[model samples]
Target: MAWRYRVGLVVAAVALLGAGAAQAYDVAPHRAVYRMALAKAASGSGIATAEGAMALEWGESCEGWTVEQRYRLKLGYTQGGESDVAVSFATYEAKDGSSYRFFIERARPGSMPENISGKAVRGPAGVRAEFEAPEPVKLDLPKDVLFPTQHSLAILGAAEAGQKFLSGMVFDGNEVEEATEITAVIGKQIPAPTEGEELLRRPSWPVRLAFFGPDNAPGGLPDYEMGIRLYDNGIVTEMKLDYGDFVVDATLDKLEKLPKPGC
Candidate 1:
């Protein structure tokens, strides 16, 4: 598979939800409305090889607010030997109990490659896809992309109502292997910085996540450990993937409520 497609699959897998319930968090609700920013760097021999950042915002609507729920992701990466960089964006919204929609876009710096945009629908049976291409073309997704466990995990985390799916499970990728287990880890409250006094600063709680997996089961290596810091409010603020010679870190930043499109 191509690198761009691989990246998109990773993002979709991490952000979408599956059919099972998620593990419960032992935190309070007041601390759930904050935003988290993460910065990740991968380096070797004292030279930085790859760097990326992610930001997440979770909050209720203010007075007279029409929007109910929102989630967005922006990712960029630079490989060690590659000269060109890659960037991608994904955004999702819950319209009601019966329907939701998502948008995805990816681009390389110089080439006019065809951009991807599609929507997924959910109903009584299961989830299905309805996509549109910029031109007359065909697209195929990985096996895991169609049945993503990470996306299901994120949804379970955000809902905080499911706890049965977080137990002993294995996530197998063509090049990556991840195991999910529930463990009690201490969390801390981080204070939000004030910019201008008018902006409200919400308190954020950070919790550590640990598990065992292959260094890069599908694309790169095997036998590695991964750790991530997730805010109590259900946003992954930081992630570190280590496989001896290669390491990747991701951070979140600049989280704001996405504006609703006018009809």
Candidate 2:
């Protein structure tokens, strides 16, 4: 259950940062960047693979940019058939550098609230994201649940040492590298995710993410891998997740260039 909660939160953040409304043209100068990462693990017992892509877009509207993300996974167990799962189709707004609002549209089967709209506010000490359900449902996130969400922003926002962005959290970058590698680069613009359009655009900084095997212990989970390609303005062009027995793939099928939001 805790793993499910963490995965759900990670998926929500990813969807908002990678797939939501903020694209390269819509973001402000020097405010935000884009990143994509893949993760894979394969074991004799089962194979698990995941692909995550994110966009960091700044907003003059809310003072801080929004994050859009999209992710997919394919898992196969030695004794069971393969299963494909997608998590959190949503956008998140972080305003004034500390508060967050999430607009979630989709989730894996039976893994989310009926209608998902929520708010989270972070202080100098900690951050908490809350959801509003029609009826009260017991929701408890694992201790490590905030790592990806908070640390992702801290890394993007350029937080420094001795500063408490997520407060009381110490992220071992080396540990992160053990499981995933975040690579930043510049790339040519590609078509946006549109229905039936062909146009080329370039972004300022593009990033890719690759996840490796579980090095935490021997005889761990299998080796799985995924890759996401993103633009500086926060548009994802391609996503891939592959394990020996399962795979999920998505490409920028279409894109639409809209008028830049008035600052």
> Residue-wise lDDT of candidate 1 within 59-140, one digit each (tens)?
2221111112222323333433433333343434342222223343444557774354454444556444444544332223
User: Can you give the lDDT of residue 206 in candidate 2?
Assistant: 30
Stretches of candidate 2 off by over 4 Å are: 1-88, 105-117, 133-199, 203-207, 210-225
State the lDDT of candidate 2 residue by residue for 92-152, as single tens digits. 4443335555544434555753345555555555545455533222232323323233334
Question: Number of clashes in every candidate structure?
Answer: 23, 34
lDDT of each: 0.33, 0.36
| TM-score of each prediction | 0.44, 0.44
